[model samples]
Target: MEGVPGSSSEHECDSNSLHSEESKLRLKDAIKHLEQLLLENDLVAPESSGTISHEAMQIGQDLYKSTVEILGSKMFVETEELIMAESDDEEGQFEEIQDDDDSEQYMLPEKDKSMEYIPLDYKIKVVNMAKEHPKWTLKTLHKQGCSRLKSMKHLYRWEEDIKHGGTIIDKYSIINSWTYDRFVEARVNYQQVTTRNLQEWALSAASQFENFPFKASKPWVIKFKKQNRIKQRKITKYVTEKETATLEEILAAADIFRKQTQVLIPNFHKDFIINTDQTGCQYQSTFNRTLSTQRAKAVFVQHKSSNKISHSYTAQYAMTMSGKLLPLVFICLQEATGAFGSKVKKAVDEFVKIYQNVKVTSSKSGKLTTYLYTQFLKEVLSPYVKHEKFLLLIDSWGGQTNPALYDDIFQDDNNVGTCTIKVIPPKCTPLCQPCDVYFYRQVKNLIKRLQNCSFLIEQKREIASREDCIKIHAIVHHQLSAPIFENMLRYAWFASKLTDEREVFMNVNEVCFPLDILKKSCDCKNVTFIRCAHCRANYCFACFYDKYHPSTCTVPSTSTDE
Candidate 1:
């Protein structure tokens, strides 16, 4: 109770100062604890610690130091461990809550499934389903129990691949094996790989591959166009073994022939070069294709009488390298009797009237004989050539290459400088014969077209008579007349190596015999004529009878052996 001098004031001041210091110390401890908790939980960043006031940071550091000193290093370590364990527990709880939310979101039926979870079994099922229901979309597949296959993009990709000849099964190795086997079979057995063959092979191939997931239709096979083959040319013995003159040999021969001709006839023109060939035209009409139902077993047209007769006329045509087509010489296979025969003769007369160079002869078998060949040379070639030195190209036929015929033409006193004959190599007609190479194909095609026209346009079903055949020939002749065949002649000459250039022969005029002179000079009637089944002989009844009527002669002799 006694008031000492300045003692109360000093005591009060000391107490106030102690209380303020205590408050500051408590605040420091709380901040330090807060920082420790934040650090343990990874909620506070060390980098952001500098944003706190310097005074507050200093107080926190001092409290942390004092606490570390009081509790010792072991106690501090224990406290840190406790804080970390609590923080870990809290994090585990939060993660569990988040996982519950995520599970609920994923489990919802409305959520779209990802393709990552699709099993191989499910993918295969979907593919099989798609095959069964080709019109179904991916959503449809999913609705039909393929829940794993969710995306239409994946489904469309697979569908497109299969649609365009792609297969889900790996059967390429098997296909290649079968193809090689079939190829060998074709090579050894002379078999062709037809569409049916391919279909059969495809069925076998599909059988080998279990679960082949595509239709093996014609269109599907066609899609693999590079793999499947069509229209391949068959390798023939003739193509492989046929003897052809080498380019060098051909060129050399041509040069030698040219030099020899130039020596014999100075400045020999292209018109002087001539080629002759014989082709047969059937009297019967034929069609390449006819109108018929696709399902029909067979289609037929009316068979003409010509078809039953099996008669064909061997037409011998001559052309200059310059393109001048001479009149055709038609050898009919008929006797000079009956309506058909008379009609043939009349038609031949008509042809002769129109084209003065035309010559008609008949044989039981429409083929050229030695006598007929000689007649062609004398009647057709000799008058055309006259005294002009000419080159003649002919195929190597027995009658054409006869030494007697050659001698008769070249050694005749009047024909001493008339012509020279060159025989194309044997079996090389397709390569070397100008007529075979260019003219005959076009001629045959035109004849076929004419026959078709006669049947289809004229509606004639009866067999064409000899007269009709002659008329057809005449029509074809007029259509492919001199002017038209002239270009073909040039092309043939160029193609057959007979001429160096078509341009060199463009200016040559057509060579035609004067009708009056030709008619006066012809002595065909005086020549003896006999018909044979295989060929005809134009020999005098008094001479060359034995020679003309060989063992193959089928004709009965009408003349006595006097």
Candidate 2:
């Protein structure tokens, strides 16, 4: 045995070959047993038995071919040799082999697969699916076999982009052209595209395009805050297109007239330009917000009775472009009788004593009639026109724009050769009339404040009498000083587009003499003065009665020592 050591190795090889032949024989016998069991159980139909046998035979042939190819490979032979060597080294050792479960405990876990890039086809599928089932969640899609999009956040962003008219196809994809065009068309047409509409469109697209890879869900749709509704403003007077057009035409004409007047009357002073307008003054206090408990619902406000005859007065005023204010004309509703008339007369006399140009008139209705307007022009306006040429601006009131009134003013013997009358555009008094623009608002505000104070005073005492109303109004009128009037006049002219020289309108603080300046003592020493009723000049009372009382007196004349 020691002489032939190689003979043992040859015997061992023969033994291994014999073991492999026995294992192959056993495998063939097991396969034959499986076929016989299937035939006995009749699991396959008799008609398909031949087909099953043929399939089995074909599978076996494929298996044999793969086995032959693997065994003939160089790598397989090397692997077999390595395994044999390892087995021979362990043959002498007594080792405890592990079971399948014990071996799994020691084995390393399989690594997680990396996130894969989604194809354009898959993205389109997702968008289409989202359109169909807008209410489905990402988890729901995953459960239904849509695993292309991994995260809910990513899915929601994609869904939102599509809803906002984003194209599903990639920018560089060949099929992007059609998708982009469709997206643009949808965006143009769907002005207020809603989540539901987007979802429906996506689902519809998915149906059209076969092989869509993703599913739609509710969790993928973004929510938005609802827009707040705005309240509309209420308009009292509805201005029509025709009225606006007419206003524009009138404005153009007014501009032309202004330029022409400037050229024609080159030396016309701003002081010679005048605007007059009428406003209503109410006896009652205007409603205004007052401090009260936050929760109080019903607040009692004191106001006079709404009697047109006794509660309202028509106030007409004139303002020069140089900011000089003329005396106010109050047209009372009552006739010249009773306590109302007496109080008005007393107030007028007092006002005339203080301001020479003031006048008070009465009418059945508290409005300026043509006759009253003519009286206002004669008494209040005409006295202030010291220039040879003057401009009178008035609104388009029927009484104010009367042809007879215009003729009277121009034909007046006292007027400076030229008296140009310009009627403001209809319904444009607030913007074009200086009195309406500058004076009336301040007058109303002051009047209201005074009225409110009087009302508060009356609350603790007796009701306000007509005399009290008249007194309050007089106080308010007197408080409108020269400087205030001047500022208002400048603002009015500026607003009306009448004057551009701001400096000319400035410095309105110059001393303004009241109409009753002549009523005071004459400048002469040691002489009693009397004012002439016509020329408004102070004279010795005896001399004026003896000389100027019967004739028009031009200058003050003192009595000479007898």
Candidate 3:
């Protein structure tokens, strides 16, 4: 008996080696045909020397390695089939329901499970084993490598199904496999593919099949990720809020908006069509990067105060199609009751006189509310209406879109004509809204640089008070309003795809601090202290401090007073 067992082990080893050789031969032939197909389809890119690129070679090697690994692994058997069937088999069985109210459900398609499939060769082997050993029980068959057969009844059903010419492959299996391939392709291209993205892609690809039942459920995602060796990782690249829609969708909406507004250009002159929006400004914006020793272990830069980065004020800007920034900027400072306290109001009132172009007010959130928006239209926009009719392009913010906000223009006895409002599509602001496309970034750049200069030049450590922030806002707006920046303002519109005419211009940083300009002496004939953002002049520290610049205010105990 011992000698017989030894002979059987040797025979099994020989059989396994034969199977391995056959699999290797088949894989080699398949790879050869795949290479030929790739060449015919022009899938592999060649270098100038007419040789395959290194990238292409690397890709092919990776594919070959993965195929070899798969072929080396033993075929999986569904050992749990009996348990699964038994659990669900009892018709009126009471099952415990688990609460899942807090969990979010996704409708992504399920991954193709190998267990759901039985290879034709394996089926034939199992059927032959049963017929040759007719007295062998189901447990005996399972111990002999027919582990996936749930019961004798299942074996009989499989025989009948195969006798009737039914296929071993499940319906829609190929399509489901293709959907997974598409996901892998998308992931390789650096797309931040979400569960929704997978679901949508699967549904679109499977739409041709009737009643395809893949929902891309949570379980499917788990299995698909595990099988593909994918891991969830944080995105290192810059991303924006525009992911609500695809690039094509955003571009299409922008094109529609451009066409719609272009038709009205002839009716309203360039100066009469205005684009306006509000942006939040930090009191003391600081640079997130700075100079340090090349091999330093760590780097640190000091900020004025925590509130400088945490608190913000709103500044609204209006620019016409003629490339002119409206003369005034409407500013709303954060305060309770949407109005400044006694002390702060007095300081703001006095500051506005010095800087006439800034109309300062207060709001609870420092955001442009409907009430504050109406005031902006009246105090800032109404004064600039030179034509009988004008067009306004704004975002879809609730405050800006209020119908009552435009009633004054239509109900005017002064024959001001009708004011038409065109809203930029939702989530399309980054591509179609002029202010968001280019203007706000430039403004923020200016704010951070100015704050850094104050720290480096004057050595001020305290946070920029509300008054200093307002002053900085005025200076930045005043500088941007210059005739020199006209083309830059127009470029905002062009960049947003609202205008066809392209205007080449430098942003605030490049224009203000050119190497040649920075080399020159100040107007006071001394070393340049800082470029006066308000007057656009170079002044020495002494001259600027005594005459041009205001003394830094004392740091307040809190951001705002009651």
lDDT string, candidate 1, 1-562, tens digits: 1542222332332334434666557546756765654553355565665466868667666754554332332222222122111011121111111222333243314444311222223334455455445555544455566665534345544333332223322244344444444444344334555444444444434432334542345544453334544444655544233334443454355446544543543346667777898876666635335888999998765564534335556777777777776655444444433123665567767755654435667666666777777877877777776667777878778877865675566544554645677776554454456676557655665555444543234544443555555555554554455342465567666555445444211111111111112222212453332222122233332222223233233443343210
lDDT of 2 at 209: 27
- TM-score of every candidate relative to the true structure: 0.42, 0.42, 0.54
- lDDT scores for all predictions? 0.49, 0.47, 0.61
RMSD (Cα, Å) for all candidates, in order, is 38.2, 38.7, 27.2
Error of 3 at 502 (Å): 2.4
Residues 117-206 of candidate 3: C-alpha lDDT, one tens digit per residue: 554335545665565566666655666777766545555545543332223133234334545655653453345776556544444333
Query: How many pairs collide in each candidate, listed in order?
Result: 3, 9, 5
In model 2, where is the ten-residue run with the lowest total lDDT?
78-87
TM-score of 3: 0.54
Winning model by lDDT: 3
Query: What is the per-residue lDDT of model 2 for residues 136-170, given as tens digits with 9 covering 90 to 100?
Result: 55544554445655443455444433332233333
Question: Where does model 3 exceed 4 Å of error?
Answer: 1-244, 294-297, 410-417, 454-458, 461-463, 529-537, 541-546, 549-562
* Superposition TM-score, candidate 1 onto the true structure: 0.42
